[model samples]
Target chain A: MNTIALLPHQQSPAVELDYTTFQTLLRARMKQAPDREFLVFPETDRRFTYREFYEISVSAVDWVGRQVEQGGTVCIIFRNTPEFLAIFFGAVALGITVVPVNPDLAVPEIRFIVENSGSHSVFFDPDMKGKLVPLEAELPEVRFSPLADVSELPKVDVPAIEAQLPHVEMTTPAAIIYTSGTTGFPKGVILSHMNFLVDGKGIAEWFQLNADTRSLCILPLFHNNGLVVSLASALHAGGAIIMIDPKASLRSFWALVERYNATFTSVMPSILAAILALGSDGRPGYLKGIISGGQYLPPSLGKRFESRFGVPIFEGFGSTEATSYSCFQAYPAERRAPGSVGRVMPISEMKVVDENDMEVPDGTEGEICIRGANVAIGYHNLPELQALRFRNGWYHCGDYGSRSREGDYYFSSRKDDLIVKGGEKIYPAEIENVLCMYPEVTECATIGIDDAILGQEICAFARLKEQTLVTESELLAFCAQSLARFKQPKRIVIINHLGDMPELPKGPTKKILYRVLRDYYERRLANSQDPEGLKWVLGSQGGG
Target chain B: MTIPELYAALSPLAEQVLRIPQFDKTLTMMSTPSWDSLRHVQLLSAIEQKFGIEISGDDAFKLTSAEKLVQYLHRQTEGKPQA
Candidate 1:
């Protein structure tokens, strides 16, 4: 087994791993380029220069700092807006652990993360009042603040702000991003300030970002792609941030790119498909390329979008546990492998390993594991699980991919049957837990099936306690209450003859055979097979 | 295209992309949930393909509704010298 350590391009500057905290970096950039625009909203014709952004952020830090105890957790749930980033940077700048929650999540979902992270205070979008209002009574210990909009964030004249920058260590916990595992519930992934900076520097250097480069924040800030890859990278490079309102037009995206003169943007495969559907009509401005990740993008879609939009596409592979990305198509233009997730970034160590966590030979498909400055410490409060994941000094990514002899990596299978639908990760255990609650359900499993538009849509299989006791619609309705819209099964297959299907398909320990089920779904949903045939007695379309 | 012609051109897309049962000048992207940001983009894509005109990202927001988009399209074509 060999580790692939990518080298920085000769033209690319060395990644700065010396920055102790985000505040130090932000203040450094402010000193370097105070007059230059730091954050720009092209659609609204509003721009915040480095000095202005810093001053505004200074005020936010002051506001949030007073509310939380030293090193206590602060959660921010907002749409893609000025207030969101400001509060996020404010929290990190103060050395508080910021929890970035999906603003669209229902109160119960929000409650789950809030309780798990033990948030001392929460700052959410005003529009989320309906959902977050319940938390006022539900979690009485947690303080809440509703930022009206970006427009309302005051830019105060906070002159000696450096004196207020909190002292923080590189390994100090900075963020707790919630991710689901086999536990059927979201686990809090604790990331350090160094994790963000290390990944940011790697991404910035790889993407060739500098003072002139501007990146658009189209991905949600809750995801590392938006916060670290796009935002922190730009900030670290002394580049600019073009914050697009997430709900903005897809056709308008290219226009925004040109309008803002954005040099780089981060995207997902589904967003690429949408951009490709528009074809090559708009005159794109300064967009050099897109940093794509979350799900696999076939080279065909990459070719179509790049040729049509006249912008190159580079895919990356990483997760919350990796802080951002361990492997990406880095610089020099010439070393990019279009079909793969590119080579390991210079800052991290990557390799493929066997089921026992032993190193597998190069070119053989195995679980991809990474160890680096960017790798997260472990899940918060889950020591047993942490020991399992952090064995042999490597964070074992459950994803199955192989490193080529040439040093490039390719993703062969999703980790732990992860369903990536429209760039959102849905774990089978989360949905299966809900399905199991129904009295009629005896056993259940969930799998992902590829779709033309969305990268993959969810397909579920369940064995009922009584043969004809439950209807598909009834189970789907029950699921809708517990699951997010994206996680809801697009199709459900009933295993009427469960005994005939390989005697419930079990592994050595009598664990349900998930691999076998996923393979059967792949065969059943193959392009050559009649997908409808599986729906006859075998399947039914779930609610939405 | 005339106002009526513009309405006719957008009718099908309004149904397919936006699901506006009946589109009129009063119907804006803000008025319908279907035309929310994502669908507004799909609508813009359809309109650009339908008319073969390019709208800049800054200009896309100005085409807020059927009336504004049609008026803008008419202005562009009218600006063209008689070919």
Candidate 2:
């Protein structure tokens, strides 16, 4: 498939920052104009110019080189702060595979990622010690250190800027980003340096970002959207960034925007919905415009927000595999086509393919597959799974969508059993495994129910052990300990396995037909088809 | 709206959005464990729908306590009981 960039033909990176490593790029930028501000922490009233940021990152690299051994992964688990920047940049500079974990998640949730990704050194913000200290047992091998001490690191003489053999190649693995896998365990996608650099430049080009652009980092630093869309794009565009914690309230979101005069930002659909719910006062001040990604932006909502706020809401589409965005709408020059994810960016070729991997016609709905320098090599430690997904040199997105003859792409639905609630991907297997862990539960399956506020709500159907009684509150409490708040089931339906019980349908392989369960819930969601036998064990949302 | 009227209005909001059994003076943002930042948005959306008024982003952050939200909503609908 021929990749088409929908950006204006005149758009290009103001400063072409192509280099072997981010260390080299940072050094080059610092030398170009050291006084230019790179990042601003508005909450703390702290700012780091190109020169200051480079000095801090280099000293961080020196500290890690001395204190931590040179063997295993160095994970950075912090919120949106300057510390996150130093730790991630320093680790990436030293060619250490960095795993950015969301600190806001529960400790057990964080521990799951820490356990899966083997790491020797873990860097975090000292302020988060209360939440992290409890996880010492889960990750005993990890050497913990706070990033505050990095303030004293500027004077330390760092090693020379020499690329170590076999460690710092364009295709060498740079980071392991974990996204919700269809199966229970989360799969880490191994991204290369080429992926970051190319995706950064591509985003800068598509967004028409320049040195004057002031971007906002509202999304959690752990997600790929935060890294590629906000940080990396600003890094290469020579623009500044406004870093704020993800917990910032809707009011604070606007305060930061007005305070920083932010121009570019990428937000999830839910955030936009909340902002628009504010009616007239929702629009942020002096924004060039904002783009929406990470989930579907309903055309009506996008159009409503745009017309009300006087700001264009361009919709883009990408996954952890594509680094950031494979499809994006060009702003200013043309208005967005409501549901379209725009055209494929340069360095990425996207095609809508059928079951046999053949390209389908323009208007035909098919699996959206992308091939690009930005696509991750494969899933880490999952060769068979990788082979299944990365077929024909195209990374199958597992997303069902179609393309236009004009080169725009339109999303339809997901092919995999994934539920996106408020932009957080929740696989049914994860919730089901947790439910089946209870002694009273015999069989359980989680499915997505359409919601008006959240994009989808999780509904769990369980067949309890004969004569075993379990309260909805008790089961919800059990789920709270294992899953994040967003992943918890919104409703639990207790299915009796007696004479009138409707056993879940099965396929040819005897695997439970998740489609049948999903359809039943989908019908129940329509306000008229709810079955009388489906006992509501959870919240009243279970019933119509 | 009196405190009783305000409490009556917030009963369904908390139950629907936070999935709490009931609302009281105890269910402030800092008190209720589930009334975190994310849930706050849903609560505000529900309040807006129930009151037939818009909650500004600034007001959403300030209306942390049900008491404060009631005061604000009470003032907005002070003149007309129909509101």
What TM-score does each of the candidates earn? 0.82, 0.82
- TM-score of chain B, candidates 1 onward in order: 0.82, 0.85
Candidate 2, residues A336-396, lDDT tens digits: the string is: 6657888888767889999999999999999999877778877888888988888777888
lDDT of 1 by residue, A1-544 (tens): 0122211111122344657688778878988889998997655567899888877788788777778766889888875667887887777887889999976554567788988898879898765665567688888988889887654665555765657666887778889998766777888888888788888988888777899988888887887778898888998899998877555646567677776788888888988876665453655578788888988898888887776767778888998898988888756556687678989888788889998878888899999988777888678999999888877778887889998888999899866678888788888888899898988888888878877556887877888865466777788878877675557787767776444463346788988787888787676545643453212211111111
Q: lDDT for every model?
A: 0.75, 0.73
Stretches of model 2 off by over 4 angstroms after superposition: A1-17, A148-154, A158-167, A333-335, A497-501, A525-544, B1-36, B40-83
How far in Å is the alpha carbon of A83 misplaced in model 2?
0.8
- Which candidate leads the pack in lDDT? 1
TM-score (C-alpha, index-matched) for candidate 1:
0.82
Query: Who wins the TM-score comparison?
Result: 1
